[model samples]
Target chain A: MLNTHGLDVSAAIKTLVLILDLVGTFVFALSGALAGAKHRLDFFGIMVLSFAAGNFGGITRDLLIGAVPPAAITDWRYLAVSILAGVLTFFWHPAIERLRSAVLVFDAAGLALFAVAGTQKALAFGLNPAMAALLGMLTGIGGGMMRDVLLTEIPAVLRAEIYALAALAGATVVVIGQLLLLPSAIMAIIGAVLCFAIRMLAIRRSWNLPAPPD
Target chain B: MLNTHGLDVSAAIKTLVLILDLVGTFVFALSGALAGAKHRLDFFGIMVLSFAAGNFGGITRDLLIGAVPPAAITDWRYLAVSILAGVLTFFWHPAIERLRSAVLVFDAAGLALFAVAGTQKALAFGLNPAMAALLGMLTGIGGGMMRDVLLTEIPAVLRAEIYALAALAGATVVVIGQLLLLPSAIMAIIGAVLCFAIRMLAIRRSWNLPAPPD
Candidate 1:
């Protein structure tokens, strides 16, 4: 019953989204691998950390939203991507560290993509708008949080710049777009751009959430 | 085609399992809250840690096995039990800390219970035996792992006494019992007792996994 033109358009959009997801996974994996290198973890440890950092956020979100057997576990491509990132970082951390700003930008991009994707997934699963938005933020920050925890550090999401808040902004935008019945491709782009812009600005301006009184 | 006596027996077993599960949740919550208190976290942080410690293991297990809308979220009693334990620990940490041996015993009990329960749940959901057993161990140790991470400490499971191994033993027993078509109640009890005994022995004798050479 579907028109060929409509099917082609949807397929192209899906392909675009999938590429974005893989890019997000790769950047996150690189970050995890870098953290492992900084800590002098063994090779196996680096790979494990890379996979955890790249996939844990989506895994957690999938678990919470009842998307069981998470994509991270079931999909071989994700595993390959994370491992490749780890191997690359392990071999070239010195060079990568010099590109810290670039890493941050990629991380921000990943956060944007994850926030929109997570929100859309939650809505698909029939969650309320508020909870969906929260899950989106969680999906954006959860992997980094887990990575820091494994390194025995307080999560950056809890202590650093407006990371979680930016994800929240993006997710909220997605939810509003849902309410307005906007095309998902357009909404995702808008939400991702908003999140990426806010995160970059936070980094540039050194914006931080208020800390608890010591 | 339902038999009255069979239904009664099943219902009674279910009740027993539920009671054991709640008890396990409470002890885990107590340990988490105690850790939070040690770190000088505020009341809200303590509550969050308690909830994470009490429920994350089961949540993880449920997610892996495709149990949607995990019981920890949908069931009110689990929330109440974790909250109560947190409140008690926050107000009485000094007294609780004085009873370190008692706390360890309770932790072991919870570990045993969760191991058996998690394995059974996985089996019920039709996971392969080896996978179910692994999930059971994860159910036993996952919460504490998350708790330690949140507190910026290495998980005891990765560095301490025979924690995860004991859970695996218990879960293996459940799997073997299932293969033999043993009664659920008896299998659960046997598995729990075995896990608890092994854990207690390991603590008493200072058993540890082999560490990497420095």
Candidate 2:
């Protein structure tokens, strides 16, 4: 039985969301392999890094939101796609750098969409605002965090960037809208747009956190 | 508040169990670092792999069972210990390998203890047999599965190993004893010992599943 206390996206919206999710996974996987190539990793290591980066976000989100069995574990399609992406990445890394700027833009778009959608899913399950917001933020930034950790660099979120902050802003908007009894679709659009805008601005401006004094 | 479900461990036994858990984590972390070393990963990568390998199983368990935030995410001490273990492994690969056989034994011991403990926790929370058994199995092998995935290897449990099977056996015993209204501690000890014995036998015989016909 589905929970009745939250908004259910229309078929069209659901289709859009699913498309974005797949796109996010594919790009994230490619990016992961690219990062590994930068470090001169072997093919096996590249695949491992790519797969981990692609799936970690969604896996963490599903477990947190009480989605039993986890979507990644149960759905062979996602696993198939991830494996394919990883394989493709291993063979094609030399050409990826030419599209580095474009790839970052795509990642930014994913962060925006997942933030709002992930939070909405948690809220639908009747979780508290704090938990829902956290899940949303995680869904957006979790993959990148895993990638950075594996790459031995600080997480991009902890560095200077609007990446995670954009997600947080989007999630905050979602939670507040729910509390205010605003329509979910409208709030979703606004929140997503807000995230995209923030992330884009951050990128355009080379925004970064100031280095701390020792 | 802790729910013991009227089953109690003696302070001595409980202390022993905790020590076993730490040993298990250390072994698991070492394995992760070894995987990283095979890939020629950096110190940061080694530490991250170690942390993930050491805690992913219990973290997955707690999250699946609705333990909010999961111990891996919420506990800094666990992260510290796992990373430390990884660093030590990096600096002493030869020494680590010298103790490889002993590590497996400790891991097996942890598997047996944690599997029974997980099942009991689920039963006390009033979950059904199927869910409790699944979770117990997860607690026993989930971390290693995650480690393998991150290292781009097949999960050890899904192979012909006696891993998840032992956990299932333990959980089944617990369920049957509960149905029969048996004493709790007696049943717990029986179930745990049964799992441990089965695992030892499997390792001794080099038992494994046959490869499927292509």
Top TM-score prediction, candidate number: 1
Instruction: Estimate candidate 1's alpha-carbon lDDT, on a 0 to 1 scale.
Output: 0.86
Cα lDDT of model 2 by residue, A37-111, tens digit: 676555545655676677777778887677855655544555556667666666666566777788888877778
Q: Give RMSD (Å) of candidate 1 vs. truth.
A: 6.7
Off by over 4 Å in 1: A1-56, A59-106, A122-135, A142-155, A158-162, A165-214, B1-23, B33-52, B59-109, B125-138, B146-182, B186-214
For model 2, residues B176-211, the per-residue Cα lDDT tens digits are 787789987788788888988888888889865432
Report residue B213 deviation for candidate 2 (angstroms): 32
CAPRI tier for the interface of model 1: incorrect
What is the per-residue lDDT of model 1 for residues A1-214, given as tens digits with 9 covering 90 to 100? 2465556766677888888888999899898999999999999999988998999999988888888788889989899999999999989989999999999999999999999999999889877676687678778887887788888886656545778889989999999999889887788889999999999999999987643232
What lDDT score is found at residue B36 in candidate 1? Answer: 79
Instruction: Quote model 1's TM-score.
Output: 0.61
Error of 2 at A45 (Å): 2.7
Q: Individual DockQ of the candidates? A: 0.17, 0.07
